[model samples]
Target chain A: MIGRMAAAFAAGLMLATPVLAADPPAEIKIGTLYASSGRYASISMPVHSALKLWVEQKNAEGGVYVKAFDKKVPIKLVAYDDQSNTATASTLYNQLITQDKVDLLVADSGSVLTAPAVAIARDHKMFLFDQTGTGASFFSKDNPYIALMADPVSTIWPKPVADFLTHDGPALGIKKIALLYSTNEFTGTQANAVRKFIKESGAPVEIVYDQGVPTETTNYTVIINNIRAKKPDAVIHLGYAPNDIAFLRNVNEVGVKFKWMFSIYAGLETELLEKNVGVKGLQYVYTYVPPSELDYPVNFGMKMPEFRALWNKTFPDGKVEFGFNAVAGYTTALVIEKTLSVATSLDQMELRRAVFSLSGQLKTLDGTFALDETGGQIGELTPLGQLVPNEHGHLKFVAVYPHEVATGKPVYPRP
Target chain B: MPSAIRHLLFIVVPLLVVFAILPGVYENHLMLFNFVVFLILAQGVNVIYGFTGYLPFGYVGFFGSGAYGFAMMVMHAHASAPVAVIAAGLAGMLIGLLLTPLLRLSGAYFAIANLASSLAVLHFVANPALEDITRGPYGVSLTATFNPEAAYWAALVVLALTLGVVVYLKNSRFGLALQAVREDPVSAGMAGVNVVRMRVAAWLASALIAGLAGGVYAWYVSVFFPDNVFSGTFSIFAIVFALFGGVATIIGPIVGVLILYGVYNLIGFTTPQYFQLIYGLLIMGLVLFLPAGLVSLVTRRGRHVP
Candidate 1:
């Protein structure tokens, strides 16, 4: 009886041992909200599905190994459908962090949706890894809890376009660039950033027409006609895939012409553009993404390529874009994995510290990166990608910007 | 048990359950306050749609006014929530009093008028002339939690007081007069019942409840904007509870509100997006089957319909 009592006491001590007393946590719970069932579902849902697949692949390899924990721990992703409603999105997201007790948080798809989530995360001192949301204010607003997984839209994106415009303008016999963007906070911020970047780059950017249109407006013939009438050196419009697809179809149909032209958003969507307009139509377009950072040792990071391969094998008929959306989801999982491996159990404060300390290379598909103190990237940079048609007709990941990541030379007067 | 003890037991049963799980159910005082706001609003909506004969479709309109009134006063005008609540009530009373003419009309007209009032308020809020004052659509933030416990306690007090008043009115002369107006205005008028007066009073009282609830809700939610404030769904939810509980009884809306709140939360835990669909279907079913509502079945045999 004495021996049994002693054994029972020993077992109880082991069971009751606090996570902090032992190795760091082996698993972390990430709460990510997205437009899973609403207007933004087409893009956001794919990111989520891709993310889930990445997590499964990681756990399959015995989870992430953190130096802090010195063990391989798995990852759990908790996603909520924002339904494209901001209020519902805000309330539900708050509940996740405060009530459901999630380890870390990931941003919802849109900027409007992410703003409140980011604010709440900052207030509570949680690491909010913002992936899909690209609004400039996210970076502008002083907060340490949030990071720009998708490089700040207003910060870096406009710079390259402006640089290319300035460098190639006089050389390529092009002069004027027209800026068009939506009225939303993210697009507006980008539009403003582009304008600022153009002036800094010594490019003559005459915004021929700056009109805000409603989200539900279907007919873009008039808008395109208005732009065509401007007849600038190039036309750069920023919007979602649906809006871009509609505008491009109409622009193509009307044979509206421009030189070295680019668009803001839809360039990243491979499937939507191909199904609607072929890759030939999308050739020469450039969009921003985390410099498809060359892969390193992290086993899960290596699995991204295989994940894409499996996706290709599973749905050969489908074509997906190689933009930052896929990277966003993958990055979130990476951050979660890192957090989990660093700790023995998912505790908010410990996970928060781990996220803050992420300064060196992160093995995300986007690239090796680190979130700075302000939750912004320290040295991580976004490189521009050109839509080069693969032999299979899908676009290749050909980085053509920042000179260093350039695979192919610029097609200056891209059609 | 004494009569009071029996009634007290009914309340205690749930109180004990909530007390047992309060720690797990709520993360902090802020969330508890949020629940309090919803509870108060549900009860107020119950009073207007459940107790009164009027179909006040613009329940949220009054609520919006109260929220903005408080938000505007405290954050912008540098006043407090307590003062803001009173100010919001006064504003609600003024609006309700102004709407006295519409109460002369019955059923659909009352609904249309109330709807028109809310939409008009919404449009006015969007007007650029007032944009500078109302902060347009960006909404005014409450800065911080701003006395969360106080807000929660206030909500509790309001709920208890409203329940008592509604019950007292249901059993008293004013309630009878209001019921007479609802049952048959012409007959009520012939029986020396000041039908219009009772209705107007009820309408004003209902608006008062909405106003107070809205003001409190603003402090709890911490952000007050026109679009969020004047949403028509508030009225729909109010109607759901009123019908669910047995609209005429003081207790009906409260019971219905609790059941639906539970239903909503239950569904919301897993999939929040489809909770509204469930709500819509449930309300439709209740209206179709139990015209008198679930609250009408005070007797055991009445529940045996199967």
Candidate 2:
């Protein structure tokens, strides 16, 4: 009786071994798009380059681990240039799905370029790993193939800023506000959120001057003069990197300064903004404090210090700036790696499930990876902060809002 | 065989069949759809510039207008894709009519004026004050009527119709008269060709073609911003493609789209890092070596090219 039982157990073990060790693919194909040159290049290149760097690093380590196959597999990154053209992006995205048959589909950096991928991915039933497209319209209950990887959704991005204004502004004598934004989806949605939050708060503050200029507006001297006429206590300018550079430069050139000022890119792409607007121009400007500045504790992937060092070593030329977008790209790569490790199969829906399962569980340099029901990122929120010149004469972030993360008091009424 | 029939059987039919059956064999239907869109746009450029000798630098204005026209119909009226597409064509024609005065300025002036007119339209559609209607710069999303297969077939049908128009221009007396007007408007007027009327007709027809292409494109993509449809690259590509083929001929634009666009996709897919540099060099080479376009090669040999 003992000999017969041992034979049955040995047979069961032999049958289960093959099922546990499934055949692995030779390489995991991750496809994505980027803008090499054009308006969006400043934002797109850093994200794409960071992703490329992660791919090279992993492949150097003999590849990432895949749980389904019980082995490590090399990563093959297939990227295409959209040239910042949506039609071209649409066609290339389809090629990635149909022709290249990439295992993972990642979108370009911004909302305009990523818009085409949102629809195309759904049509083809391919899951899209949206990098930093924070458009509010992209998230809906019907679409299950996408998730925001890095930035918070635009609708909620202005919460900390708005919270600072409504809760803290009345005491600081910030009675009037001026809101100026570039009329595009990312900034426009943030602008809307700011307006809603301020209105709903029922605070004593009022938006004295509210207007939107074209996204391509380079000369803001006239707009600056126009805003000065309103005499608002605090001025908020929402725009991309180039817009911020131009707006800040114009304010300095025109020799006008409001008591308080805010701009998005001043904090998000600090390196690029510093190079363009100069150190003196960004002094006392309020903006979001990115992860690179905060150095959030990580539970997975490289820590902020290590990632920054690797980035500096890899990109020695300094053509592309390292900022929030650089961190964003690597965060996305980490998510992809984790997803591949947990997914039971290479199927599209299975990949999505694995990605969603990592929500609230994965932590990296970008902060906790959390998602709303519609796949919009709810965690990794950047707190409102002010750029104050340090003793070394270089601008340093002083987190002002969301009391838990406050590093220093805001120096309001800039001299 | 009759000349028009021969051109239709040999050129148009084969092109249509290839695009129709390509989705099954080639898998990338969006690329195929884009090919068809470019083919129609190139031919549209051929119609105006080839037949009337007017270089419309802002031809994408019509395309963008058509796209918005389709969007408005779908978003506000809740019309189906086909109806919205027709509205798109009408919108293009409407803009063409509105800019009819631009034709009065000939040569470089007309081109610049057309370009300015397009930019004006772009700003108008993207203005924040009009956000309630056009959605301003926030963009439009029409997933309710999203049908890629249907939109692809619609694009194919539009391509066929555009080819028919071009073939008619290549063979009919109206075409010869339009060419005469292009060569010398005074002489053509002396010969009783109704120069103004002929120019306007060709201009409207060209606008209609682009408008239809834009509508079909919007339907296929189902989500876009104003910048996507109004991109100056569309106008530039269509003009380059039309000029690269020998223009005026039925096969010239077709050949241009096939060869130039094919090389474009090949470069874009293989080595995307050097895509812009390589494509720029290729265009420069074509301009320097084949000034009259590829059709000139056969025409220079004294052989008729369809």
The sequence of per-residue lDDT tens digits that candidate 2 reaches over residues B200-235 is 999999999999999999999877888788899899
CA lDDT, candidate 2, residue A329 = 98
Per-model CA lDDT versus the true structure: 0.64, 0.92
Clashing pairs in 1: A24-A343, A24-A344, A25-A343, A25-A344, A25-A345, A26-A344, A270-A321, B50-B247
**Under CAPRI classification, how is model 2 graded?**
medium
Evaluated with lDDT, which candidate comes out highest? 2
User: Model 2: how far is A407 from its true place, Å?
Assistant: 0.5
Per-residue lDDT of model 2, residues A1-415, tens digit only? 8999999999988887766667888999999999998888988999999999999999999899988787899999999998888878888999999989999999999998999999899999999999998877688898999999999999899999988989999999998999999988888889989999999999999999999888889999999999999999999999998899999999999999789999999999999899899999999999999999898888899999999999999999998899999999999999999998999888989998999999999999999999999999999999999999989999999999999999999898987
User: Alpha carbon lDDT of residue A195, candidate 1?
Assistant: 76
